[model samples]
Target: MSLSLVLAALVAVTDSATHNGRAGQTTVPAVRADTTIDVDGRLDEPVWRRAALLTGFSLYQPADGRPAPDSTEVLVWYSPTAMHFGVRAYEPHGPVQATLADRDRVSADDNVEIQLDTFDEGRRAFVFIVNPLGVQADGTKSEAGGFIPGSNVMPGQNDLSADFRWQSKGRVTEWGYEVEIRIPFASLRYPVGAPQRWGLQIVRHVQHSGYEETWTPARRASASFIAQAGKLVGLAGMRHGQVVELNPELTNTAAGAAAAPSGDWRYRNDAQLGGNVRWAVGSDVVLNGTVKPDFSQVEADATQIATDQRFALFYPERRPFFVEGSDQFNVPNTLVYTRRIVRPEAAAKLTGKIGRSDVAVLSAVDDRATTSDASRPLVNIVRLRRDFGRQNTAGILYSGRTSGARATTTSPAPTRAWCSAASTSRRCRRCRA
Candidate 1:
């Protein structure tokens, strides 16, 4: 058969359970209910009972199906301290060679990326990628700038080992060989509570056969797990620590210069001290304040991107001078300045949940060195968020800047209003639409 014809057949076969003679025959192993754990350290419960797991349905697709000799089976589990994931792969055809590229490099061929949404909503989550050779890929949030590699916490061999287990199982009919994995808790983060719903995706790659697939149906391979992850049900009685946390920091800087009049290089060190405090008022609320904040750690622009087409990709500041829960305060189109905010000689931030509403507020004053050119402006921002449940949210935000000068002029004050919704059910109007 032509490659296109074969690929079309494979797509048809995988889309539902009828195209292939194996109609209802799923390659995924049957998961027994008894071999799982809840968030409260209880056994014999579903892994989703404590934390969320991302489903990986799009990673596997046959490249012009030709009976390629590569395949994999995956099992998932979770606990309070960590999440467990295991994959058994068959490669009788031959191993495909590959290389790693990105912030923290790892082999890209024949790998798995498990995306998890603790809230069963795509708004927030983590992405973890693991290669057949056992290389780990991770990313995180920082205060001074966009996601950078320096912030990555590489899992130690012991930590990865604690969560991963593998066993080689000879072969399976005409498909190929097989290998299995078991992942443990202590490898993930989630909120503490009961009856939680998690979004999950499991990705797999068969480089030689050029086949990739998922347990759940997926539109494409490159699609983010967040977009197509499936829902994990039956979570209740799990223990997650408070979703809010506080972090504070202090720093200093020095510089030197030379002039012709002096005919000599002069060195000088200047020390300016300041600190910022953050309080997690609740799951959706946070508060932050800073005195003499510094932006030294703020990252430089990406060398590869020459144009500023999209909104300047903003990086979370790491100076510890801004609230840690920046994502919670995201307003669609308003200017919510948290980083490089004219180095407010002093500032304060408030964020968190009140009842079912989310709120955030910030106030800061521009200092002499940073605000001398322009009239020192005191900046303030406030926002209120309302959740409609099941991943739907509506919110309003207001931002303003006032000059310290006598004229007391404020211009270009902006406000934003927006709403969004998401769901897992294929029948959900939002998902279908």
Candidate 2:
């Protein structure tokens, strides 16, 4: 097939799932900043007056569908290259729970959370959280797939293992606290060059009162959390600058040994070249690949002492290449597990949205399996999901592996499921083949 035709096929699946503001869904207008705004935890800029204001939050925890005791006001706007938010949390008598903690480690403290489904896909959301003192913790929320047994993951929990580049500042005041956030378009992957509609939800955690409130009425009766999110519209003329990342790595090691009873000493040095590359294809799709990539983990995983457990232990994936777009590959009973491709020699992946469909294609060549070094296998995975109406999705998956003359492929029948995020664990209300 021609390259243009292939691209068209990849993106032109169907527009039936296009979102056009659900019935009774609240809408928040996103204005373009008219002046320069600083990120100093103060909404003193004149532009803030014209920015969209979100208030009248409804209680989400302790009791649902009730007015909150405290008040919170959020201002939303955007620049050509970035999105900005300013928030003022009002606390009258209760003390604020905050501390100077490391990033991605402040869930215990009182915090504010901003969830953005940039693609308007209920399957996943990018979560940005900050404490009163501006301590940051960011991650992604996967709502499409049900909870995996023995994965050490809780229901309705955000995976704090992922991090992104963003700017934030906060300060405590006598009345309450204020926070300012700026997220560059490059840090996020979204459709570019047109007006965009995204799902937005803002949450405030009142520590002393044990109150959790949301800008939208996210009642416990709701089936999906993202489905209850308000719509953010009027985001136009956005720019996702040429996002090209190249990580080049080199390592050298030397060994010395004595030869013939101290007659002579010989030394040999060995060097290896490896790197990873990522390219944003038209802001909506990303192409990632690695050549002899460094598979070393940047941080060690939390120690998991194996006890007599019914299921094997599951460790979180910390590799950058796999974690980048991992959300797209998530499905009920997760068909594609990247960690299985141990000791990868080369790998490439394509993930993002095309039209109203989420697409992911991955291929990897494993140098050896964990059980035996003599086994070299090639793995491939393809996933496609379409979203329609509110909180409804249908998808298909295909996985294959081949080694030498042996090959195996698994292509389950197309399945349709509507997932509910109301309880601690996600549940698929209906499933059909």
Candidate 3:
């Protein structure tokens, strides 16, 4: 088999509360729902009336720190197994634009967004968005310090490749529109403890009105978007038990040929088996693996109009294996780009948090086309990082590759760490071979 073998191990540590600015100060209670929430976009549930109400949204675009012309009310509450949100947006300036489009394709329409930092990490967030018609889009957002050197790929960009199990509904009202959302705890990864405090923010986009407002003061000058998020308190007894998901696929082919018209037909049949598995060891640790997987692309790459492009385009990772818990793999430098792994015969990844440290390990055998020598290069990468002093992180990266007669290693010199969207002065590392 023509393949390459790779093993990656990462260890990092950070204090979640240290980097989060104003999160503890501006707080919203996540009430425990006493009654069931019927996600019908009507907000008729009794729990909504008793749940914490979040209001006073401010303009985040065209201007900042100013009260929005229109008003939006959000209800925050939770059950033992899931978190729920109810949004009522009043838009008197213009008509709401929406469509029955596919998922992750509702940015052109008037929409509401929910940003949750499950770990209160002040950098990464899971974003759930819905249009007036209830079309949904969800993804993970990573906040890196700045752009890596020699790459057009910007950090802190959002990747909508991840899909979670959730429920939502929306309806257009006379005042504006309302959206109902329920996100299960199983679909999220948080610290393995009770009384969870998370970073929360809500955003509304008025396309026709040409305005964007957020529940908090999302200033453009802020260095970190998540750091400016409000706090979510009162999640006392929530639990996300171990979750296991298995997807099995089988392929079969049959062929027949006859040498002569009088001869009996000969038949050939072949079958192959493959699948993917995910096991949540706990709330924070997860194991993902694939065996003889049918790695197929589901979504097409976004179109880019490049009239005078000088650098290669950057396409985010969309494969299920690479996208799961991807934020844990992010570093100051783009050391391990999973897209280069092309075709993998087998792959496995492990990610979790232990104490203040984060750990991630990935092992894969890439089935790249090769020669008669049947040589598979062995590649190993290791990264170690420690974050301190509020958004300042220091990390070391080492990658080495060895084939039959070739060997190469990369050890980039460390520099300042992650760029915060909330910080004004910071620097990023320059990765080199």
Candidate 4:
């Protein structure tokens, strides 16, 4: 027989063996006992099927003690204009309490969160998190920081809506729920390309039963989806339009001055104008920068008590200059050097991929104040890093500072150094003697 015929027959046999637990059952034509099946062809068949089977793909789940109904099956589909999601949660028990309260009223019991990460495969992506009660947790159009506190719906801030529906059958044993989400293409941003993979997670809260089952496995219950997410494949031919953003901010600050013995009130105000620019540099890399970035619009840090008696309280730098992915430039085991580096008022960043390696670099002039003091002299830092795949990297770092004259009629002295290294290990070894 022809090779194509032989391959097709073998596929039938392999599919039957792999999918034995599924409902379907089939047999393949018997072959010679000594025959060795082509292993490459067998592996290629399933991969192609996985890439092609865009609709009706169910998220894989391992055997665990989580209460998963035998009839529970999730169905997912996508279109050009919007992504369509449907879930057929077969609750074998009687009809349970499914309420639609304000998003802020979410609790551990009987709640569901639908999270979407547009750029699932890359470092930067937009995350949209919504609960069953139409409450949104983090609705930012970009990746969130690790230290930012979780956000609940604000009072009188309820303009967003989620198009959802459901139905019940018999008792809690045979109930069903369905949700149809129409995420506008304009409202979302994702890297355009063929075979786009996305990180996704779903959490179901059974309030009455006090149970929570996550679609993606996670080590911590409250961890963000970044650390724990499953892949959504077969996203070829997806495209994103120009990213347009409009952010207008206003600020008013007042302070009162009081003498030690007598108390008196004095008022002062400072106003500033600021905004950010986001433009796609080609398709994969996104260029982001801010002019006079303002942190007054951002929320205050969440309250926390310091239990440790030895160390000072931890306060992350809230400056906008540090928020633009600058922390990644920090050199490991060199915290003092990093802290002394002058923060730049103007910066130009280049990030994305050049061939197989991921490249990121930041070039900026250090602020004047940080470099002025001799004790904690501020120095300009130019951090460059290129990942050579899986633990391999090449980096070049330069820092310098000019100190003011110690006495009259003298010029400032300059201090500078260049550090370069290449490493296959986790830490970069200084190559310069």
lDDT of 1 at 19: 16
The sequence of per-residue lDDT tens digits that candidate 1 reaches over residues 1-433 is 8999999998764553211211222222212233433222112233433222222233335442122233445555444333455444555667544444442354346665555565555544555655654455543221111222222222211011112122211122233322223333223344445555676655566556556655445554432435455655555434333333334456645566786896787777767777656454433344566677566765564445437686464543454555344444455442464655746788887765555465677778876566545566777878777767645678877887766564556689784332243234234344443
User: What lDDT would each prediction earn against the true structure?
Assistant: 0.47, 0.79, 0.75, 0.41
* Alpha carbon deviation, residue 197, candidate 1 (Å): 1.9
1 against 3, candidate with superior lDDT: 3
Q: What is the Å distance of residue 294 in model 1 from its true position?
A: 4.7
Instruction: State residue 33's C-alpha deviation in candidate 3, in Å.
Output: 2.0
Can you give the TM-score per candidate against the true fold? 0.55, 0.82, 0.79, 0.50
lDDT of 4 at 46: 25
lDDT of 2: 0.79
Best of the candidates, TM-score: 2
Two-way TM-score contest, 2 vs 3, winner: 2
Model 4, runs deviating above 4 Å: 1-67, 70-73, 88-128, 138-177, 183-192, 197-203, 214-231, 250-270, 303-312, 316-356, 361-433
Question: What lDDT does model 4 reach?
Answer: 0.41
Question: Model 3's lDDT to the true fold?
Answer: 0.75
lDDT for model 1 comes to 0.47
Better of 1 and 2 by TM-score: 2
In model 3, where is the ten-residue run with the lowest total lDDT?
A: 8-17
Candidates arranged by lDDT, highest first: 2, 3, 1, 4
Which pairs clash in model 3? 145-418, 145-419, 222-421, 222-422, 223-420, 223-421, 223-422, 223-423, 224-421, 224-422
